[model samples]
Target: MFNESKKAMTAISQYCGNRVDYVQGGGGNTSYKFNDKLMAIKASGYTLADVQPEQGYVTVDYSKISRKYDEISKKMDIDVEAETLLINLDCVELLHGMKDLRPSVEVGFHSYLQKAVIHTHSVYSNLLCCSDEGRDNAKSIFENSKYGYIYIPFISPGYTLSIRVKDEVIAYKAENGKMPDLIFMESHGMIASNDDYETAIEIHETANQMMIDYFNSVEFPKAIIKKTSKGFSSKTEMINKFIVDFSADENYFDTVNIYPDQIVYLQNNLGKTILIDKDNASIEYIMSEKQAQTLEEVLLGVVYIITEIKRNELSLKLLCKEGEDFIRNWESEKYRASLVND
Candidate 1:
């Protein structure tokens, strides 16, 4: 039995570590209930690669956290009950090893989960959460599927996200006669559950592959350059010249593959562009006519320059690489197609 649990932990680590889109850093977490009294969960700030059967994880008393929270909430006002429960239960100590390690901010949500749980920030999934088209695409993808899922709009992570999920699960169970098997957070990723560890992982894998297959069928426009100048100019010449003069490197002068929304921005007049920052503040950028070339060039250049300038970096090389990757494998294009077909 001990060996089986260790193998399960190892398998969970391998699954999460292999997918860059699912977890780049220590961004997601997994857990399994050992029994009614105990649970084993991935430790905080440690990459899945670092997790083994013996290192940097915790076997906490599940009943303790639940019981303490229940007791504290009863004595506290409703408005402050959750907060009081978290502190009084000593939830912070549940994170084993590394005294400084903080339990996952989503612990509250995890506490209410069943036997096994898997949370991920998969790129394809989160992209679907970012816009209306993506949301609808997700709904249709799982509409009649055997694995039931719940979708929640954008909400802050940690306490707020947990509360929202808990409330949604309760309402869903009341209306549908069952709790969701999976949960999708808008602009975030997903949480899946099953009574068995392997089953939970399989469910996540099945859903992930379905999404990948859907994206592979999408057709994005190939990068093409055409020159209207009546002088001695070829398509390649125009494209090369455009890259040399505008971009940081000629090698990076690739294609201008824009999504529907990006096309709108590219076709807009050349001048200052408005963008929203992480803090929700508006920022403006002034672009010269030289900066905006062919529609594709404009699209690539604008994105490259924006990221570069924001990071105060010397070059936009990485930004260009990201754009190339997006054109080659972007799920947004598939999502856009899904919307049109719907």
Candidate 2:
């Protein structure tokens, strides 16, 4: 089963990497468990398409980590002491030895799953997660689906997310007498699994298609842009403010650039409603075709914005449903290598 599962992992990785809507660059991870003793997972910083059975895949001993943590905690009297002991336990050494690769931050979540786990940052899933309305829309789509779906709110990756997933899975099993077939992370993506490789892959693909179908059914309101030079500076300022508020990262600062689409979007509708006082001199307008196009793409697209702050790489990604325009956009097609140069 282990060897077969390894092959399945490689196949799934390739499938995900090949589909830009499913994964881009190093955005997703996959795993398979042979038994209580060993599990293989995709390595960090590697695309699924290039992963070979022996290269990007890593095998680690799960029993060792679990046993070591359990043993150390039982011997410790204080919770603080137990946590400190667990962090420094030899289990860390064992993890480090697993191809010297950093395991997925969601490793704990995978450990609790069955023989195989496929975590993908699919565009459709992200689109559904980003908006409050989108979440409800997704729930409605899967209301009567055969596969169990669980939605978990966004949490920063690492131990916090891993522990939350573990607890949620446990709670779900206790309540329903079964584990969910898929876990949807709000503002993130999804984790899916099954005993059979084909079944797991099918579930993921079908679920994504369902969401895409739902998104396509939505009638987007047309954006009407109004031209005004006085409003441009003010609109840019407002956009900058919105970006800062949304990200709350100092690194963004004044470096945020409002492209032509954004300018058109703001000058059209927002400029009318928002008052332009001295302190709030920013002009507002409605959405523009370009902005609408961009927003539509963002809702249905997989975008990764790589920024450099003080020479360090800062990549901000928005994984959402790919809009029709985006799919047909020459620039986007080129980026995905879906179009050939003449």
Candidate 3:
């Protein structure tokens, strides 16, 4: 058990760490089911990189959560959000070494998956996911894979998304006699899961490579930073070019968001902390050093997705207006965004 926990912690950090831009700030989660009932998942407000062998994750009775969803999911009168919050809290195990932390909000879906699961907002996956032609493109791109993939249409996050995913997985399993290794959520991100950690990692990396090779995408560029009186400015050519190309369009920022994490980090900062320095062909953010860096990564990610979509001559499938409004008003996302500075 101890060794499994340590391995899970290490695997979580690898996806969230510097080796790959799989996630930014507190945007993604990883989980490992220790047994039929107990599962370890990243805490709600902590980035995956903060997870360690003894802290930054929580153990939950995943079977209980899964059962509760099955029982209540089909009922029409339940207050899903409130019920889900209560159920999640109740399922948390008061374990010895685990921190007293709230599990990631997407735990509902995690409980339904295999032993090892990684959910990331990868730029490579989003290149196909955030485009209007993404669904068809995904079908064509991954058609020959040994392990088939599942593409989920855009669904609001939280319990609802979990339910949707559960249904899809159930349907897929019925036909294929097993779970899919890769699940792609449109306008969101991807999930790679397997019974073991190493295989799960391989599935994720291979899926990312497939997309990158298909589009011939260059490596995502790093932010070129310079100190400013209030905060920091990005001199990255790609980021600057994006601002220059779309600064005249009033709706560009709102429409350019291809994933939920982008809105979580950038929505509040825009026009306040984040500013366009068109004169210098740079992007500026008025915040502390830590906050500035966090925002820079997210902004760079957004621009990277846009540039890739444009470069491939693909039509962008942006988040709808309603989805943007929901994310802006979501308290859970607001809490996660707040952790960026801490």
Candidate 4:
């Protein structure tokens, strides 16, 4: 039994890590519940494709997480500001050799899930999640299908999103008599959780293909991921030119952000030579080696996600000013971005 899960973990890591389409940057996470008292989850800032035993995941205390979540979440419901909740989040305990490691912020929902969980930033799945009519379309498609799923509208990642997910799962079970095996997080990606790794991966695959087929039938634009980044163009002139050409709209700030991680990956780091001052409605060209590489790494994702949005011609969902401010200020997110930047 232990060996099966171990092999599953390694396979899961390799499968996800080897594909940027399934997992990008430091986004996406995986977990396995060891028992009622403990669980092993992908540590923050690590990729699923390259995990190495306990080195890749931190085993957390479920009992401690559950207790603190209840406490902090209850206060979050009453408190208007999110600061106190952030401080209280530290209450969730890490076990054994994992104390120094940071757990994925999704631990709340993972703790409430099955023995195995696999979440991905699959681009094909995002074809549906990022669609304008995605929720209604998903309902029409999966409502009576054999696979059970719940459509959650865009929620910023972290305690708040998990709180909603926990409640949604509870309500789904009450209505459908089963844990939602497939959860489509609108404007984000898909999440699959089940008693075993294969079950989880299979569910994601099924839903991902369903989304792919659905979008394909509509004659969706081709997925244009550049498989190799070894020869990516980092010339300041080229980077600035693309920024001006692609992100020149007057409403750029209001509409350009497509994912929270984009902020983590690009917000402060992108366009060292080109800067967007939101309040001033301006773009400036500066210079830096760190900035060039940072922009190169995250620039493609930004361009692609936005390009997909335009291709669909669907009323899009962009990160709001408040949401952007919140995520950019987060020290944890900054740290995660630094891992990639390093």
Which candidate number has the best lDDT?
3
Candidate maximizing TM-score: 3
Cα shift from native, residue 267, model 1 (Å) = 30
TM-score, candidate number 3: 0.94
Off by over 4 Å in 4: 1-3, 76-99, 217-255, 273-298
- Please report, in order, the local distance difference test score of every candidate based on alpha carbons: 0.52, 0.52, 0.81, 0.64
Better of 2 and 4 by TM-score: 4
Model 3 root mean square deviation, Cα atoms: 1.9
What is the lDDT, from 0 to 100, of the residue 246 in candidate 4? 63
Q: Tell me each candidate's TM-score.
A: 0.57, 0.59, 0.94, 0.78
lDDT of 2: 0.52
Q: Positional deviation of 227 in candidate 3, in angstroms?
A: 2.2
The segments of candidate 3 whose C-alpha lies over 4 angstroms from its true place after superposition are: 74-78, 248-251
lDDT of 1 at 223: 27
Error of 2 at 185 (Å): 0.3
lDDT of 4: 0.64
Cα lDDT, model 2, residue 329? 38
Candidate 3, clashing residue pairs?
none
Task: Provide the global lDDT of candidate 1 against the true structure.
Answer: 0.52
